[model samples]
Target: MAHANDAELYAQWLELLGWLDAEASARGLSFEKVADFPDYIYRMERPYDLPTTVMSVGVNSAGQPLMIAGVSPRHAQLKGVSLRLMGGSKHWHLHAGTRGLLEGKRPFTRERLAQLLDGAVRGQA
Candidate 1:
């Protein structure tokens, strides 16, 4: 199977972040982006004292690129939920820890963003 090139991966990553930003706005959540070299960190602030969810782009232990979401930066690195490109397709697949892929590969959507945020905020992913 073919794999996505760096350009394609970066473009998809930007699109995913944009979708999250829009969703955060619609949901009345505050969103911030911090660039960290090849990766970009995203934080979503919810109302009240709820934990702010952090997400960033990084490679897993296996060296696969993923968009990881979790309650903290460390959590995001160690045990966050991941959205990964499947083959050369312009689609992202949800992955949950060692259990691997959770859902079919698909384009980013509000529903998917919600799921990711929920998992990140709750530290379930």
Candidate 2:
């Protein structure tokens, strides 16, 4: 079976977002932030359908990469990990919306997203 690492997953996500932003930008796509959700959620209506996080967010300019800014999924939360989707309140803080980036999002089916992340950061992507 095929395998994926966190870095690779993140790279894939980055690449995927690059493509999406291109399209959304042309269509005047907008953003919204939601409370209780870390930034990866586009819509909470589909909570059970969230993908896994590959790597923690770094830094960058807005309107560039669609970002779902939020506390790490493993972080402490009263009820557990927050599932905030895009197009809600505080979503503006994110560069790329959660759903925006997740259009093609899915947990690494083969390898772990963490490994992919290591490779990407090492310039293997």
Q: List the global CA lDDT of all models.
A: 0.40, 0.32
All candidates' TM-scores? 0.40, 0.27
On a 0 to 1 TM-score scale, where does candidate 2 land against the true structure?
Answer: 0.27
Encode model 1's per-residue lDDT on 18-100: one tens digit a residue: 66667555545555543242222333352322222224543222343223432222323322234533233333444332222
What residue pairs are clashing in model 1? none
* Candidate with best lDDT: 1
Per-residue CA lDDT of candidate 2, range 1-125, in tens?
Answer: 23233334334444543433343344454333223335444445655323443323321224432334342332332211122223333221111232322312443221232333233334342
Give the Å error, residue 124, model 1: 7.6
- Candidate 2 weakest lDDT stretch, 10 residues: 76-85
Model 2 Cα shift for residue 120 (angstroms): 31
